[model samples]
Target chain A: MELGQKIENGMEGRTGIRNEMQMSFDAISENEAFARLAVSAFVMPLNPTVEEISDIKTAVSEAVTNAIIHGYDEEYRQENDRETKKVQLHCRIEKDMLYIQVKDTGKGIEDIAKAMEPLFTTRPELERSGMGFAFMEAFMDRLEVVSEPGCGTVVLMEKRLRMAEEADEL
Target chain B: MENNYSENFKVIDNYLMVRMPEEVDHHKSGYISRTADDYIMKEGVGNVVFDFEDTRFMDSSGIGIIIGRYKKISYFGGKVFAINTDTRIKRTLMICGLHKVIEIME
Candidate 1:
């Protein structure tokens, strides 16, 4: 299986310290908790302080919520006939660093650059702050988004664990 | 959980107290903005303090909510203060530049 496929196949606490979770929801705003729970499980083992954990959870929530709210535009709720739109998440921990990838099989971002700007959300009517990437970038050390217009979007984030003293200082 | 907003006014002193619910993110920003705007219009209470002791998580959107109110209140010769932030909420608010604009109290 390919790396992404392998990650999807319940690769948790194995050779490379990777964990993958899969769930398909109606992509409704109210279902944001499901996405948060999945990412929390992946990040909990990193031994992040309580505050850090919350930060990670919030970042994950924003990304997955965007996938549901913006990417699918609430269409997934009515797509009972086909069940096409779904959001996926994959995470791995390697060498004192955590990497998270959120994938969405919905409308791909047409303008990645514009989408990343602070407070640049497409769903203002829904009160979206358009600060999804901004929050992710603020919490994690690095973030990357790869998408093809007709395909999908994959958001990759990496956070290096700070040394004990460094964490205390901050 | 849904965010709840309520305001109390000190008639003689003209200070406003805003009680914000948990997790001020994208979903709750607009509601917060509207509530603050309403307080400014109805009570004419400009001096305000936000109590975040119960708030667990806040994203960048939350910053916009605070900044919007800060700008509005400051224009009328008033200031805003935030109180009792947990570590997680504190870091998030700081990262979004809220620390520079408002007074933070323990």
Candidate 2:
């Protein structure tokens, strides 16, 4: 099943998506850098400013890291199926707006609202700063989280580049 | 100010100086924390200063690293300082209300 078609969202109806991509990888800490760097490269065509690129990269890092650390519980190994738990990185670029969705099929969030609260971490003993969702909300123009217990979680984020707005003015 | 560099770690003026990596994320947090703690426990540094001069990107994991180190030393009357933070790092710290907790040297 394609992750893009898994859920219905209000954003799917929007047209003019210039580009789109979906990738699935094993849920592992090492892939965090791979995920964010790939996203930075994907958005390069938008000619984002250094600050904008940093913002996008940082947001992507938080979402993917959460999926790995919280979702699969560090090392993902299924006792029955032994299938590798996967984290899906999906992106859509429409005009100047970038849409991102990081999905994971693992132990889903029990309470998303409480999870989003700043400094409210479920794993403080791990020295988690409890700022993952907070930073995502700060860096992205819009952030939405949908999760179900014993199923999975998808973090949806959107950002509009200033360069794109300047182009619209011309 | 003896530059005794040991694996991205240094000690200056009794402060443990941790030179942050280029990209600080969850993958690297564990290692960073373990090494910094060694200094706090073994070397007995008075304070901790995180150097972000080479860091171009940092996620909440960076915040965790800093906060974890701060907690380790604070009970012993140690202070945590962050130096060379770029706009992104600064904003990350500010968003989490970390500026109030740690001294940020811009």
Best by lDDT: 2
TM-score of each: 0.73, 0.89
Q: lDDT per residue, candidate 2, A27-84, as tens digits?
A: 8788999999999898876668888899899999999999988887743345414365
Per-residue lDDT tens digits for candidate 1, residues A99-160, read 78888877689999999998787776554556789888887889899987757788888877
lDDT of 1 by residue, B3-102 (tens): 3245332333677777666766656666777877777788888687887877877766676677777878899789888888776767776776678878
Best by TM-score: 2
**Which window of 10 residues has the lowest lDDT sum in candidate 2 chain A?**
A8-17
Model 2, residue A81: what's the lDDT?
A: 40
TM of chain B, each? 0.83, 0.91
Error of 2 at B47 (Å): 0.3
Q: Candidate 1's C-alpha lDDT?
A: 0.70
Q: Considering the two chains of model 1, state its CAPRI-style docking category.
A: acceptable
Q: For each candidate, what is the lDDT?
A: 0.70, 0.86
